[model samples]
Target: MKWNSSHKAAGQHVHQPGDKHAHAAGDGHNHTHGGIFGKNTELIFSLICGGLIGIGFGLSFIDGIPPLVSMIFYITAYFFGGYFTAKEAAQTIARGGFEIDFLMFVAAIGAAILGSWVEGALLLFLFSLGHALEHFAMEKARKSIAALTELAPKTALRKDGNGTNEVPIEALRKGDVIVVRPNTKIAADGVVVKGSSSVNQAPITGESIPVDKEPAPEGSFKIEETGKLDDKYRVFAGTINGNDLLEIQVSKEASDSTLSRLVQLVNEAQTQKSPTQQFTDRFERFFVPAVLILVVLLCFAFLVVDETFSTSFYRAMSVLVAASPCALAISTPSAVLSGVARAARAGVLIKGGRPLEDLGSLTAIAFDKTGTLTEGKPKLTKIMPLKTDVTEVQLLKIVVAVETLSDHPIAKAIVRDGKEKLGGEDLPAAHDMEAVLGKGIKAALGNDAIFAGNLALFESLDESKPSAEIVAVVRKAEQEGHTTMLIRRNQEYIGMIAVMDTPRAEAKGALEALQREGIRKMIMLTGDNQAVAEAIAAQTGITEARGGLLPEQKVEAVTQLAQQEGKVAMVGDGVNDAPAMARSTVGIAMGAAGSDVALETADIALMGDKLSLLPFAIGLSRHAKKIIQQNLIVSLGMVAILIPLTILGIATIGPAVVAHEGSTLIVVFNALRLLAYQGK
Candidate 1:
């Protein structure tokens, strides 16, 4: 196509009503899926067109038929590099929308009008190349989310009465049993009815460790519904099952599965623009029109200075090329995408660019007591046998027997401790076990009746029987924030087991790192009593503690802290804490590998139990913000300096085009540097 004819036809920029109607009617166009060449076809075509242009420019310098060949090459280059961009510009111009592409098209046309066909063609080639590179970067960043969908199985082995049949994941309904064979990915969220093996949950949770999975609890699993992580009986889709036959009853539909929700979160996050991005978009709307008007004014000023119209127009074109906002427009998104992708690889899910930016500005952080600063599992930290008559080993055996049937965290800790201490000694069975709802458990061991519970339970049975030593030990355990259990056999005081949710090994170091990153305050918020909260806080180096907080109270505490500190982040992992997380500037969920609520509610999610990634995530976010600022400064600064040079006649179209495109390339590479970021 001839450039003049095509340019005039393309100038009708607006989409006709008929075109919209055709699109609504599902016309044969596949905008989302370009034929066999795929979405990057334009980029590929542009690169080829750019190469042809280079050949054509080389041919232009030769004599005879080579110049004729160069003409052919230039025409092909114009069709490949400038066709689509000019079409878009014309459509926008028809709608009275003067976008950056229109400014670029106008500049290239002016270069051609000044008898600089090579310069104009080169301008299109470089512009298309930059556009392709930016699109490729964004595509790579978003592929992380797309990868999630590829990890899950599309079909499942549904179990029948005697035989199993293969079915699509969507066909499997809630409560439908599915058989997962060894080394297979789970098809849906479900509870294992029969199985014993370690399942790799890295796909969903970002954890490197494979968690042990067992059959569903024989007792009431709902009694201690702490979170998905606490419920080891459950498994998620996209996770790999180990070398064991697992009979799993699907609990969620295909679309409602954890992997689906994760992909949804990432997709939504990508669409939600950050503040810097929003500003850049708004600025570009005016920036392009302003540049066009400025170029026109520059042409007029040159004419008044007695310059020829061609000379003035050429200078005006140079200014337009130099002052284009392409670099500035792409600065924030490139850095944001890179930073988010890097964080995702490290098992930190930053919901969007907005949260990624907010994380860098965090002045204070509030951590939930149970699962944030400490390991959510309570462990037997202290074993005190107050009864001098009974052996420590004997007392532990009784403690284990009495608490064996309970699924409480502390009870499990006691059983674990007992098994370790017993050294293969089979404990006598506790017959006729009875539990007091909020107090303790009572069971019969041989001829003796064992009572195991709290001080309240001990006092209710016989308050006056407590000796001074027993009272002191109980008080001391409570003071240290341990969950104490009193033991009595045959109506006589025996011993007590003190359990505390111990601090995670990385908690202290993570907190220290946060302080080094300029975090001024770190507070612990918990439903646990003040003593327990303070104990964990002291161990983790938190600045303060707020205990005995209800779900709403935690929100209130977060709000108050945010008011005091400018920006505050709340970290939690339970469904109850979702409200509080929603109230904070940035809500971070800990060990959110399996919980759907935690994943949806928090702005940022840590996939594993390690707290060390918290500081690393913060540091990465700050670095991302810094990189974006640097990119913008470099891009805008280059344009600022280049525009003046063009106006003063010190620079021409060739140098201006090179400098403009060169700055954009530099800005893009600078943002890509975040992909290689390594946290200290």
Candidate 2:
């Protein structure tokens, strides 16, 4: 995998300006504050006020202190602890709605008016402290998103003619050359036109291995027999440039890079409300008004029954405060933020909350075989001479000479394999080379007319002769799971090269894991032939396989599967797979070996090509969804039980307040469990 750390490094630029000043300001504020108070002086003042209020209450029981003096001390304690909350509650009410802050404020004021001054002061302090803790928790949950914008470098090494200059990354533009030195972050998306080294791309691809890169064309620099890239390759931002010094020509500016787009999409997704959040919002819209009506009915019933107006009004106010449903409103966001943070930490970049929500309900998964299951890189598997007395070397040299002129994947594989046998660089040069799209190529190699391709290439020849040996070679290669390309010299059959794409080592294990996780239907959709696709699928434990699919055909397969299953996820890693990936219920990109189009189009990206993460991601989402459901049920149940108990006089004001706060705390804690979620 080519790890792009430039994006991660470039993201740090988002925080560079004023970061030191902000940190200094934050530290200064921290030192001045003690507990929830703004300063140590405030804490001392609160203590003094509380002590004086206790003394006043004690004096009321005795007969020496004046009642008015006692009242002054009591007022001081109320002002010290509950004053800010009272002001905030009034502000919230003026905005036409209420929150938990308002409820706690009203309850505290009611306690003070009823001569429970100590309880009211304690409630104010504890509630304020709780709100602070919740604020800290939410900030912690958002750390990953914040970190995304904090890792970019403030300055970039820009290439200026012969020398380099350090400039702000924001000043970078497309086509500008940049120098990325050892251990430095790449500032923009570009090609390494010079130098070679191993890069740590864990931030981008989620793979821990350092990828070795060289200044060669993408398809020519084959790291493994199964790993290579096509021509016209482009590396992305946020990748780390390793030990070698790289002179890269920037393709995209800092803001338009992959990492920047990912951040933008993630933020957009966060703003989109899921079904559960929508339900909660609708319920609260009606729930709050219904609670108000119940409070009115309680007051009317008390007056009709000749009860004291003061006691009835106080009870009704408590019920109204207790039924605000603020906790329920906060539960979904907390869970989603925490879940997204955890996923980013694991290297699976889910674009938004909606994709995460959809992942939980996935019942079926469709895979594109070429680049998704089997490694897309083709290798020369066999060589068969067609005519009598024709040597393998002679045939290979001609095939390589003609193929070297073309840039197709299969052509590259043949040329690469034949180049090894030719030994030196003095191979025959081909002239008049012409490539036929989806067919083959026509070239002249030193007085020999060469035609190399599939059967269509031979059919295009007017005077080409087919041999029995060539037919047998083609038949045997196809039967043994290989794609054969025919080579002709001077209208006579020469030889054939059989190429095959090897399946991934982890393919079988990943397929079984998906099955174990209750993926009822697993299918392979490929552009290859039926024989090749079926052979690969069977080896990888995929029972059902569809072959000979074009890019559009792959999309149709996903759509058909979606009709049969509850939800379908398409996993692929090719430019051809982008449409299907977008069409599926969930589009999972095999980022490690996938094209940029696949990576950008996929909703969920498996940074590492380890397909096992698919099942793990699915299981994790299901577990998170279950926990969310459990939390919602617990919160709503508590509300249902408490509202009736309060109305029927079975629960008093203090107990109702305690129950409401406890339920809120419980739901919030339950939602936090998603952060610790791990799947088998």
Candidate 3:
């Protein structure tokens, strides 16, 4: 074949349009079926090629072996090393496209024509080895992401009336009861209806400790209740159930399981590019083709300067091998793939490359106060009865009557305490109950008009106004950050109750960690009044607190922060945080396992309802960012030095190929290091 005639006619890269190239910088192509060996084809074939090359090189130094036989050994090694590269290069050329592998094939053929058979064989062998090792390393990272599918068992034990049948997870429907035995994964997200046990939730929440699982509130299973435990009644798919038995009533179909959605998002995230990667892609688009043209121009330029065409061609080939952007192309994708896989395993879902890099660049953060810095549950902190005749317990009973019929958070808190205090005692229910907007409620307690609400409920009655002493106490409670509600019965001031949402135990430490990580500011926003917001802010390490803010006001506060500080991130409890989160540079949703809105809306999600993971996510992102910069510096630096040296005849074809392929291998291995990263 007249290779030069065809090369002149083509003048472009040779690659099929739809070919799935898997490696970074586009040199690593396709995560296809393993080559000759099982799941180790590329590496194994490279080793075999290396063995033949070593034997061929050794035969030249020996006397007995004929030169013809020695040539045969080199030819066999070339066949093994160049087979896939040639196939891909041929396909690329046929499709009217060009690739780095195609350039590599031309360089190898150039070496063969120059009668440097050993040098050419070595070049092909080393080039193939780099691609093979890169393919293997990237597969390891990709498999880490794919491993999410394996966490759940293929089938679940569906409980029938007489016995249990093993059914595929796809067949499981909502409300279907399934029995989970010891040391097995829970097949669906559901509530436990029977039995008790401890379940390890690391796969779903990254929590290493096992949590105790209890029966549901209305579950008919007979077992002694042991007060309250966090997430006691809930069991999610992909978590390991400990010793003892549990029968779960599925809350969602298998397709909607937490693990399924997590896997789906992660797989989609791999396709999303970061800014650095996008820049590299644009650079490679022009760079690869330019290198080919430069090599062709340099070949003729060298021929005019040198005495022989062979010498000029060899130098151009050396420059061609040196100029290949093997390392530059693979750097970002290698690091990104590894980092994403590591994060998913730890239960931090960084949506894609853009958000992963954005997280590392955030300067300030705004937090939604409810269910974020503070435990969302309101507690009945104090109960004070105003009437001289009504004791605290007697007043609680009257309050419980109206509260029991309501499902408001404050009502639930008051009812739980009242029911616990008055042991097994029946109380009269409030009839003709009606709620007052933003103030309180009014009800008929056996025809005696009972009004139990805030101070506004008594504003219309100057004749039934409370004494000065009672009003003073209620006003004092408000300053201390308590949400106060006053009760009145038939124009008489009965009492006042205070409820407060306490700060989470780990909130302060998490905020401090963010400050240490170079986050300049942290703000808390909520609907509570300024005093209550400030109280919680002081308990935590928030830089500023804005309260009495409606949903729209929260968005305004986030926007103001973004203008003042570059790259502001909004951390929210998932649902209400959407508006404010949209205003910030990045939206972070915590407690994703429970919120569909959080998983779909936030750029990043802390799967568990833990504030501690926020600091970890940012720390891990910074580490990944650092690794990416290091890889770029090394890859570009090698190409810069090697290209000039090869063209100047200071380095030959063998050494140039060695250095180029060596740097490519180094960057890939460096990216895989993200798997070992641990955030405190």
Candidate 4:
């Protein structure tokens, strides 16, 4: 009897990305029945074995057919059907443990010894066929992630000052402009510098509709005097461009593309087992041996009750077949793999089964306010003309020119807005611009002295300051929790521009969805002032707001949240949220595309800037957990019911095999149901 080492090697082996076949390698069962070319070799083997069984049984029924001929067919069927089973059982026994395969193999041998060759062959055939079917079923989940790597184009049409050439994706470097032809897949992550088109980003981002692609936002272009411009309208690799042509400037190398990272993360995710899976592995380690001992004890106990030795042994074999934890071992990985695949397809990257399980039990979700709850940057929301002489446009012109020489975030926001409104309209250049430490700017705009600053700067200036009415207006704007800048021209107030870090359009709705999903607490933590934090929280429906938090304070807040609320999920862009996320129960990074830090740091990266995916992920985690529970119940329930029935002479070897394999198939199909779960 030659035991197989090949199947044991395949069981422990893991398939890497770009492997030709989706190895059926990740079920809790320590065995594989994978096939080549995405076909199940085990299924083919079972078919051949079944053919032998059918021939052997039919030959025995034929008149004048020798019993020896029928016996030969049955023996060949046994070898063909039981080879892998025997090998798997032998390998496990050598390791001083056993699994479902051992139980089924011993049961079949016991039946054959009792002169019930047909029943024994039937048991092996069903058990092998069930495992083969499991391989085919689990393959769909594996392919869902493996298929992601194939979405990207392997070659890019690189165009530069010299000419156009088709280059391998690996040859492309950052800042290289690649011409994406009409109706083709974009080969790299980048921004569009020329031409415009719509591109389907569903492959990478799980967005259903095609997004319009153009140069960066209208006013976002960085226009230097040297004619240098910033690329615009973010484009990801593996997305399909529409009929219009696009010239994309590659932003990342082939390996660092968002699509590649997503695939890499998903492949690693499948290997990290869930808590339930770990428990099953431990359970099987002890339970299999205990089942074998119980079978031995049953045979002895039955013999002591005056039963015939052969009869007692036959019943013990049936009990062994009934008690094996075939379904129990497979319960978690099957469902977890399918859940992970579904999440990847939906633009949610769940790191592994551990996080997937952890996310479901979360009671608090701590959000980093600046980028997580609000549209990260400040936008000019209001322009008030305090002085009647200057038009709103002229006031903005003075502000844009005066602030051009200053290096401040508020200054950049003003310039961006001015570019949108002014549109190439050259303005008076400011000279002798002096930045007032913390106040604002004082400069000379073509002989007319200009001062664009907050109220503090104006209050400090005795002669060059606004009237009380203008001062009152600025104070009112400040009371509204906005960054109000008072513009003054030679002691007369021109106007005021109010900037606010507004909440994202999707923030309110996404938070509401989380609340509905049983999230008990939604807190906002920011380094901004309390007024600004409260303002954003009011709009976004967050349950609590904590402002003026330093990086360490954010971590402290997360720790407090975890202690008070139980499990906390910290949501932020991975860059600033790393500390807080590390302290929380689970860390989720938003807008993970184009952010390597987010990809590497966060436990779950909501691939794009879609906040809706968070709720979708929580919904998925809860559902996957539920499926795992259902599978465990069905598996353990079958064991509980089948053992007593088999021990009492209610089931023979054939019926016992049917019942055991039927439960295994039931749990498998149940776990695969996670694929169809569309999250809310």
Candidate 5:
């Protein structure tokens, strides 16, 4: 996984000119001011001012109070509600800029001048209310990053020659040994040197259950290592340790731990603007000034048509109120933020809004076979003995001993099965076990020189041949999508072992869900033989399966799929698939619970091993995009409709203000709905 740290680098621009609008929206999450009143206080004060305006409007309708006192109430309402907005407008103008704030201020003040003081106050209050809600929604998005910060442990137990000492995590260095207590969070990314435990990885991987971790036996070989630390022998910061003491060798600095990186990525992703936001900003750059000019022209036209000056000006103010693009400016960011937050909660880490949008538009998705569609661990299926004075158990013991030092998946499966079947009986240790990469293993056990591997390994040996029955069994096993290893003892064919990996339980449903969500194409890519790949594909309901692919071949296949199918997301959990993942439209890493590389490289990361979140994430993105489109239509549509109505004397200042500000509220509420999406 290649992390894009440039996005999180200090001094990268996070300052937006219109940032002041955050307060008006009633965003009360964090207050920058070290003052007594925070955003909640500000929101309450504004709401009280709004009530004052309501009272002032009510007084005008009663026969008791003087009109002068009613006017004072309206003036006070306008002052309090519009105070921050007017101040922001002045600041923007001083900077030689104009934005949505300036547009709202101009429209409100113009209404007040035309003797529609109550309408002006109402406009300010509604606009502030919308701003407050938008800020609150955006705050939820930012909280995802804060949640990551909360996951990291503040201190660690460092072991030295003298004794164990508690030290701040920041003071710890790579290669330091730390003692982690049971039930405590890990303080750094490290490997286990001693002890074992079940680790709760929910904070990082979103796995609800705790994963058991044990040290790998020294000198045991493993197949398909993934170039990543195995959870059995590794520990990470932020994961809760189970009831066992552990001695860990720190492999990375505290600042460079996986939890820190997650926080940085989320921070940068939030600050990065999407294309829709960029376009809206560009439109507002010119649209705000253009609306001001159009209002002046429309008012003059009304005056020339024998309308009273005050009435014409009043019509112009109404048009101005309707034309502000507050809703449009907020549409995409609010939806993007909400979608990202929802994804985080579901254990999917989306890099940013751009990927979220791309995920929504994906036409196809390609999956890597191993550890993705199938349980990555292969299991022993059958054993066939060709010629033997040798019993099945005897041959199995010999094979396990010979394959003991091999780190291949098939070897591990054999060793695992041997332990289960043989019941703790110690086998004769094989010496001088030589591994022939991609073929098999050779070893000397007691007197006989044992050979175990593929048909290619046998063919490479001098005059070593399996009998006809053995060849038939091998063919049947290969045809049935099982990997077969020919076992030979002292230049004689002895027997064979068949192993196979099964499809994951959720594979079928997850694929169908993707299809239901409008993914037009799905393909499985694997390095296994055609029969093995095809068998898993058939069971999982994938439409196409490609086999015998090298790392580069997978990359080529992904590139072709992206061109033919348009926008493809490749999902995998191996280092071999990284190139292919990078070549696709969106690269998704699955079960990336502790892999820093997978977390950093993939555009979309599924933290847990389950495929269930894939459909949920895609559905969320689509829904968010739909809401943004709805908001744009409503914002632009209102301007088209209300402008004509106000100019023709069919609508007044008060109604136009309500409709315009109400559109912003509608957009915000629609975006907020994403927070409740549980994924269909």
Candidate 6:
């Protein structure tokens, strides 16, 4: 009954080791009854002790039965209920000095020795009940981390040339081909050699639509027509393959897949300690020992000042128990768990508490121009014929023919445009087709040579002859905020293709929200030229822009921002953004689709490439941190006040124990407030 309804439903189907439900259904009444017995142990013991004490008082009035027999029964009930807790506390103290457990044990034992048997039994029962509740609360918080481990399939269906074989996901090797059925989760990262399907990539990319996919023939599938499928595409893991049976060649093993890498990254993030946790750890180093010494001093002062030994010992024990700092110990973990759950519900998958803690302090955010700020999908914006003899159709025909063999987004845009303008014609065979990273491509089409790419790709060829016309076209496209790729046939510039990376529909609002949170300095870093980057930045409300940056240059830009500001966050999505993401204070990956590097290297992943979530994540982190501070303050203050009150004899041992346990309950409830964090 303590389990949330959703959690109980999820537990019904999946059975994992150490899972609470693993024993819950079978024991059913046994476990519940056992819990009841545990709760009543102290109450039952207290009632017996109280009855014996009352009998002793009554025997004195009756003058028949002896008081010694009643006293003996009282001792038996007191020891029976409180002995285990005291022993456990003593064991805890012997192992590592002292903790709340040790303090509670000492207080219960001291109360019994002082002839307050009923009070001792009640304290033990209440403490045990409170501990059980805390345990349940902590378990619920850990569900998110446990959920990650649950995503990996137990076994994978491996496809061999002869037939299919069932193999554990752990046994999978590199280059193993796997077949995925419709609506089934892709088990590994791979290239599709055969098949066409519309894949629902929402699990990974955060996009709701199912993207069209086809076999990557030749090198990769090229989108031949704009907004239409021509039967060529590939799908990756974390994607739901839709309504089509497709054969895919596994490129990476199960262990090396995007999901596996994401798990590893999240595990690493969970292990990394936040700044606040570090401070608490340092404080505990001295705080624990200092509190112990204070307890000893209180005892010594009472003994030297003519107070009875029993009174002094009991008072000292109460002070020690009340000031043990159990609430402080639970504060960080409670807040972190609540924050993580809140983030997951909002579609922001934060790997751990460290990033959540650091997010509030982010001063500058360096975003990748394409994919992060602009919509990653490029569109055919313009086409210009450079040579007087060349027609737009003629140039597009050759460009599409070569680009049809490539799977890059830019290549797809070129092919899509060409298919529409030139119509489907038998394409000439392109030999030795090679793509230059961050540049253009070169291929041999029979006896002629073809060169297509950015301006840098044509640096080796003479440009003066074609400079006037090419510059005019490039400038015209740039002024129109389009990225232009020049086309050349045997050193003569024939035509130019213009592509546009549109600013995301939600980018302006997301940026404004960040600005309101005091993050005023927003910058864009991209491989595109200054003109294209600036134009896109302007539209997104970004004032500073750096363009024409390589992968290394992006890292440098992030590093420079970090040096200039107190904290810098990088938001990007691409294999090229890995270095920059790793170098920033907090790295946020956008549209985490099939990019393993983006998911692994970035600290936070926005499942869908919604720019609006960036500000929301920052705001959520700030709110979570505030809750943590409040919990810590309330917890520590309670201990401070109770410890003094116990030492000053203003509060008895029974009230002190109640106050200490109550503070823990209050701090826990305060931390749970993080689950309600909603971004403004």
Q: What are the TM-scores, per candidate, against the unseen true structure?
A: 0.65, 0.57, 0.59, 0.61, 0.59, 0.57
> 1-680, model 5: which lDDT tens digit per residue?
11111111121233222110111111111222111356454455468678999898888889977999889998898877777667667776776777677787787787787777776787677656545543433333333434456667788889989799889999998778899898899998777777866776544543222455766565442222312655567666888887778887787788887667555533432333344545665776788888888888877875568877667777787788777665665666567667778888998877655567767888899998877888776788777777758788887888888888765556877899877888888888999988765577888998999999888787777786776777788987888788889999897887888888778899999999999999989999886768888888889999999986755577678778876866778887754455455455566788553244444445677877778789998999888888878878888887788878887889887788778778877887888898899877
Please report the candidate that would top TM-score against the real structure.
1
TM-score of model 2 vs. true structure: 0.57
* lDDT, candidate 1, 546-628, per-residue tens: 88665557666876887788777778775445545555667688765324554455667787656789899999989999998
Write down the lDDT of every candidate, Cα atoms only.
Answer: 0.70, 0.63, 0.69, 0.70, 0.70, 0.64
- Alpha carbon lDDT at 195, candidate 3: 85
C-alpha lDDT of candidate 6 relative to the true structure: 0.64
In candidate 1, position 592 carries an lDDT of 51
Indicate the worst ten consecutive residues by lDDT in candidate 3.
1-10
- What value does the lDDT take at residue 137 in candidate 3? 42
lDDT per residue for candidate 4 within 1-680, as digits (tens), equals: 00000011122223322111122343444455654523677778777888998998998989998999988888888887787788788777776776667776876777677666776776677667756654444333344243456668889999967789999999998878899999899999887878877676544432222456676554454322112332127787878887678987787788987667655443432323345655665776777778788889878865578787777887887787678666665566567668778888998876555567778888789998765777766788778887678788888888888888875657778889887888888887888988764467889998688887777887778866677777788877776668888877776777899888778899999999998899989998876667778888888999898876644577678777776877778787633354455445576877643134333445677777788888988998899899888989998999889888988889876687777778878987997888898876
Task: Show pairs that collide, candidate 6.
Answer: 214-233, 215-233
Instruction: Write the residue-wise lDDT of candidate 3 on 360-404 in tens digits.
Output: 888799887766787766777788988799998878888889888
Model 4 / residue 622 / CA error / Å: 2.9
Q: Which ranges in model 6 have alpha carbons more than 4 Å from their true place?
A: 1-272, 300-302, 375-378, 385-410, 417-467, 475-495, 500-502, 527-532, 548-556, 574-579
Q: Give the clashing pairs for model 1.
A: 13-90, 13-91, 14-91
Sliding window of 10 residues with minimal summed lDDT for model 6? 1-10
lDDT (Cα, 0-100) at 279 in candidate 4: 66
Q: Which residue ranges in model 4 land beyond 4 Å of their true spot?
A: 1-275, 278-286, 299-317, 424-426, 459-472, 475-481, 593-595
Output the better candidate (1/2) by TM-score: 1
RMSD of each: 11.0, 13.0, 13.7, 12.5, 10.2, 13.0
Reference-based TM-score, model 1: 0.65
